[model samples]
Target: MLEIKAVTKKFGNDIAVDHLNMVLEPGRVMGLIGQNGAGKTTTFRMILDFIQPTSGSILWNNQPIDLKAKQRIGFLPEERGLYQKITVEEQILYFAELHGMRRSDARQALMEWMKRLDVVGKVTDKVQKLSKGNAQKVQLIASVIFQPEFVILDEPFSGLDPVNMSIMMSEIQRLRDQGAMIIFSSHDMNNVSHISDDLTMLKKGKTVLQGGLKEIRERYGRTKLYIESPLTMSQLRSIPGVTQVTAQENGLLVELADENVGKVIFEKATANGYIPAFSQQPPTLDDIFRMEVAADV
Candidate 1:
């Protein structure tokens, strides 16, 4: 339960976040997306009170976020900060204690996280000695081991391979199921789409789009479909109402100006005796994001 109302941040002459408003409900994940230097990190800092906003306000559970609020918030910054020489268990325990967890409880949490991440043997190893993926896993554990009520993860999937990414995603989903308010920021649109119930797209320090994922995609209009059939891309492109057709490994991707146009093409294909294997959908979050970002430029 986090709310930001008309929040703006200024760095001298530049406005990093301009009247940005967002809401993250309990038990839901919000994906905050933008290009590099699009004010994503600055917005996170303002929310965390690491940097005060120039205008407007940020509230956690309807109250202003103060030091007490900070205690209930967990942050994993884009630039991972951990002592290179510190052992994995030591670093996690230190952070857990910072959040007021008892040493014994912290130790137990550390072991549980290590096993979940499949790095139990690395508990005594120095962070610098761990591989990049392993170090990233350690950073993630440090942020959430204390079980804060609110979690802000910026690029949490940055360096991990697919398997490790799945592990981290499962953990984040578990936290959300337990009713933690989670806000995630990343360049990986697919992962964001998978985990987030809602999404906000930022460009030039302002929100360009914000809504539930499916609603946003439908709002953008259905412009493309993937169809597997006996027809070639050339034949599909020749059909009325079909603007473009490109071949894929298994089928053809057809782009139309409207949903009705796609329906017309399907009807035509049926009449031509071309029964399709399947039809692909249109306008994913990644598609909506690309369209919005490109329009801003």
Candidate 2:
């Protein structure tokens, strides 16, 4: 649904996105992640045509992104855009109209979104009167009220409590199920891992890692293993294949030399009368990001 080919963008002498290439498939969520000032937002701007790239091209379904393509795109920028004094219903309807929806359709979409987000009781209330979480929900609804085919969400979970985060995640998943190609950008690795089918990790405007979550995790080798059993840390370390063992809040995080070693350690744990609660630890996106980016640095 989205393709970026060797796209490069510059601000005078400094490069923002350096020969970055990525693709997003339909009915999938791709998490675009990086450290601060890593060119994630700039890449989004280039894709939306808010800023032209210094070189390279961004394509949506084979053609360059243009006004017609923008109509099918919904963007919720890092800086949330909403009229503080406007009622939730009014603001959403206004955005819907901007997206070419008729007044009646806009109103209907606003009401349905309000109900879905559990903010129907505050539909008539001004955005400023709502809690931060509720206000964020309104901002999200505004972005997708037109049901755009592609949605770009930057830091959508910022400032949201766990409950609200969970609600927004469900809504995003629903959109994906409906075949909306979704690209989410966030620093939160846990959130990215939970929702993303594929992930791209950027560092200083460069692509450090990008692939299906499970595939990337496996590629990084066996970094840690979760173990819940009667075995002591000392006993685990004495095992031949075990390289490092650290206790987690719930269980042990055992590191191995390789996948083969991880298997050997697991067998040793079982042989030692240690009944594991769960015994697999694939490298997380955060783990891979740190390893790859730091190594490159």
Candidate 1: tens digits of C-alpha lDDT, residues 1-297: 788999999999998888999999989999999998889999888888889999999988899998877878889989888899989888889988888888899999888888878874568899888888878888888999989899999988887799889988998999999989899898999999999998988888988988898888878677778877666777877777777887777878887777777776676667768575656466877877787888944
In Å, residue 137's CA in model 1 sits off its true spot by 1.4
Model 1: residues with Cα > 4 Å off, grouped in runs = 120-122, 272-274, 278-280
Residue 216 CA displacement from its true place in model 2, Å? 0.7
lDDT of each: 0.85, 0.85
Clashes of 2: 0
Tell me which residue pairs clash in candidate 2: none
What are the per-residue Cα lDDT tens digits for candidate 2 across 67-172? Answer: 8889889899998878988888887888887777788988888888888788734788988898877888888888999999999998888888998899979988
**Which pairs in model 1 have colliding backbones?**
none
